[model samples]
Target chain A: MKKIFSILFVTLLLFSCQPDEIPPIGEATDYIPMLTGTWKLNKFEQIDADAESKSFPAFATVKDLTNVFPGHPYTDFSITFNPDGTFTADPGSSYMQMLTSGDWEVDDTEFPSAIILSSGSETQTIALNSLADVILGKVEFKEERKQADTGKIKIKYIYSLSKTSEL
Target chain B: MRQLIIISILIFGTFVLKAQDALPKFTVTPSEIDALTENVVIEFDVTGTAVEGLTDVYIWSWAPGLNPSEMLLCYDQGSPSWGSISDNAKLEPVAGQPNKFRLSLPKTVTRAGVEVTFNNVAELFGVGDTPGKIKEFGFLLRSQDGGSGGKQTPGDMKTSITLLPLEFEPSYFRTFPAKVSKNDVVTAYLNLSLIESSENQKLSVSDAFTATVSLLDENGTVLLTSEAFETTFTSEKEHAFSFIAEMLGAFPEGKSLDDVSKCQVVFSGKVYNQDESFETVSTKVFEFDFQDYE
Candidate 1:
């Protein structure tokens, strides 16, 4: 009887050592559900769109801020989007453009192309460059600042964020 | 010995570069003057010329094409010769400025010491009756006598040349967005009035005029071509097609449009015969004659 018990215990231990198995995932809400979580800014890229329009050879006036530069506070940024359409951010030690916090809603729930954020009377749009990667925990958003009067693109800003935790 | 040789080479290169930088720069007002334009203005910034204070400046001129044969050879009116240029080539100094001088082409006014009056470009360059393309009016500014101990601009300082705009009458061709790049959308236009009676009759019998365009490399090699777009005289005179410049070339893997060294456009049009046989009766090839940044 004791040997039988010991054999059963060893069998259970072997099964536990096996790697985790993820069930098949399908019928996802895709964008809004994936965005309802905490995200950390992984990278920020900027392109001088105006100079590029002028056909300047320096159309590559692109800046990808991965490594923080002195006096340029672009690191340590985090934001959270909730399922109820409310959002918040923690600028932390870096200065973040205060446009992220407020009631946020994607242009579409299934396949969002933009994230429209509204604070009081003003509303801003950030273009979603691609479908959210839930498995990889990554999302890409782009913002284009334009000349107010001329309505011409002056700068193109891209934000790559990684999911830090579930809200 | 090797280190000494390296040091000597570096010193010599530095001296040569300094001398080249000190050469005079000639800036033509209205830097771009069409061949048909008159009243040419020449401004000389003599801050770095070999001569000091620029007391007495002189002009030397030439017709760039045919040969570097001298032009404005009115040194001695009745018997003008290159040898007598020293007496007639002197330029007037710009008022209070010591390191500046000016020369007006077409010789509108007579200078204090100079003795020649050219009414027009033909008289100034002595074009006479014969006609040929004078691509550029070459020049080199110099001291009163470019002899020993005289200050002068280097051989490289030549005047800007103006090319006559290429235009065939009745119909015209042009491109939009003067600056073209690999990624931008480019439009090619061909005016198909077929306005002339003979040309219109030819287009009327056929269906329409066929126009096609090609993207060229720096060597004028056709990199890529576009499908022929057609336009009829009765429909509209302005016919155009738009496309992205990047779609032209097939670059190697990982290489893209940015690798394009030169992006120039070559557009051509064809008119069919009056018999409705679809045989090409006339073909016109046109280029963006204006400067394309290479």
Candidate 2:
């Protein structure tokens, strides 16, 4: 009995030493570098909307973009952080004007790339697949969704960012 | 036991994710603004971590007290928000896209102390929230005095006179003929127009600004002096203000002055603002052709 208890203790110790099982090779850390610049949403789709098609030509190709979100929609937006603590948003193609000015704070963690924006009411989060994607600027992952009848499903969204503006 | 471990791992992962999701760093650089003849331009740039879903840019005109609508020229379309003015030339992804924006003053008026805002809605609300699909940003644009002084020509006041023949039949406004015979009782009509920007500028019609009318050889001076006039308006552009100088009399009762061709309409006026110190003298002369007289 004592032998069995000692063996159990050793097994538990080994399990604790191993790193937590990380999600599939999704978003990564290097993704941050790729996302360092402006990214216009040339294409987007409504996966849950009661529409037959997934993609729609609703938003125009945004050249004056100032921000982007990796995963979550409204809360995790991009910003061109200025020296004076001020920032600019990518004026979206929606009828509403894009580009907002404000301040921002980031959460340096592993899974949820959450950044809080100050200066306005909007707050958001972006989930990356891995540390590599965070520094690379391109994020590919499946977003989980629940259908009214089907219950749960995952929708995929890909983000490719570039340093569009030097100024 | 396995389920418990999975739950703990997920919770710990969430905590770590929150820590990594901290604010992406950034900075704002002051940009130069050009002073245009009709308006002013404010420009700037944002560099650092990419903050997404931002859509509104604000400009705060810092001049004497001004309305936001009057101060803000372009922004994201939300109320008090306008769309971007630049084209797609700078937004190409392959091209290093510079997130640039500009604010301008109205063309009709000039002012100082304007502040431009390039803000994400989160910043505007001061919540420090994540920028969602509808992001908002603002820039504080302060106007600078490249010190371009007032207009080159001061007191740009103008006046014009149209002499129409008196008409018996009329539509909306009374109509008038261009010429009339000496024996005919002629009622000459005059219309005046003025353009003043400031209240200090005034358009006063005095005997000095009146024209001397004379029929060929009418003995002494038959010149008539009309009453003086002044005008102002609620609109900003050109305005029409009129003063009629009418001279009514039978051509010397039955004897028409000889050489009626000498009959003429003279116009005179002096341009002066509130301060009577500066004045400009202007005059226009018109002649009546008796051969074509009614």
Candidate 3:
């Protein structure tokens, strides 16, 4: 009888002490090397060409114009970042296209990493979060704008960017 | 007789163990995204069939990828100060802490979804020259039985900063009188109304949003300049400013608005904020054109 009681108690304790189930691993890492490719800019039909077009497509993605309003014209640009610090930007079905070649660098000083683009006459800095290469995920984009009459324009867009075949 | 006593004890122990498993859950009340010019207290109350197992409760900023350093500007000191249940109104800041604010969720949170109020006050002046943005606020409860403190929580259950639209309404105006003369004060008004999201999507609109207004003559020479005017007014909240050009100042002494060869206005602005654990929302820019004054 003593032996039977001890065994029963041990079994009950083991069953009650079971741990909670572990969640799936969903944390992401950075993608700094997946930017190497030759991209083809996509073109789109113009509805009202008379209206100052805000966004254009390139490198299989839509990116904004440097001179246009913040996030006004959703722009898609196909860009290839090589290990040598050179890049080729193509349009992704965007009629308004800008195929510019330049260098890019990342700033990790702050929490959300920033990428500064040195395209010919213009210089731009893009703040990025949830950065992953070759995988399709949502990322937050941040940029700063200085306007005349008003004050300043700080634009933020939450979009998905997946790694596609080189353009 | 010994056998019967052991059986009775076993039955009683089983019931007690089952009852412990039925402890009450915790819940946090939802709040409207209100605004204030100074520090505001966010109150959260924990009540209901209270449980005694929970060791501690914690509050965290639910927004992803925000700069921990920049967020420090929003708090009164550096951390969140807690008061007893009577009045959670007066909030003090925690000093030299990375997280913006924190709260204790002792075993007090009994019922599931316990309603709690947290005050988030707004201040007119910011830490430096910039007023940090208010992205979102939320809380997490932990069992504290040697488990992952707040990271083990399921989801972010709290209020967030709703992404707002750019305050860009582009329009131009020209002034002309029947009898035109020199040195006439020609003023133009520009209004920018900030926009926010409907679903409470997190957005940062403090120092991130800015406008640059300039006056250019036909020669492209800047007549007047104003850059980095850090300002934000909610949707339908209009901010008005006037610009005057001295026709005589541009050219010779006798030159007036009519005498001026050409005049024009250019306005540009953009908004930026952190998005996820370490990323930011795609940057946005807005531009407008005004009548050029000669």
Which prediction has the highest lDDT against the true structure? 1
The candidate with the higher DockQ, 2 or 3, is 3
What local lDDT score does residue A15 receive in model 3, on the 0 to 100 scale? 95
Off by over 4 Å in 1: A1-167, B1-21, B66-68, B77-83, B108-116, B119-122, B128-131, B156-160, B165-294
Model 3, residue A19: displacement in angstroms?
A: 5.2
Lowest-sum lDDT 10-residue window in model 1 chain B: B285-294
Task: Please tell me the TM-score of chain A for candidate 3.
Answer: 0.44
What DockQ do you compute for every candidate structure?
Answer: 0.01, 0.01, 0.02
Q: What TM-score fits each model?
A: 0.32, 0.20, 0.31
The reply for model 2, stretches above 4 Å from the true place, is: A1-35, A49-86, A95-99, A109-112, A126-160, B1-294
Residue A30, candidate 3: C-alpha displacement in angstroms: 5.6
Task: Point to the candidate with the largest TM-score.
Answer: 1
> Cα deviation of B66 in candidate 1 (Å)?
4.3
Write the residue-wise lDDT of candidate 1 on A16-134 in tens digits: 99999888888856667778899888887765553343233331345454443334345588888888998887876554555657899988777778888888897877788755475
Chain A TM-score, each candidate: 0.67, 0.38, 0.44
* TM-score preference between candidates 2 and 3, better one: 3
Candidates, ranked, TM-score = 1, 3, 2
TM-score of model 2 relative to the true fold?
0.20
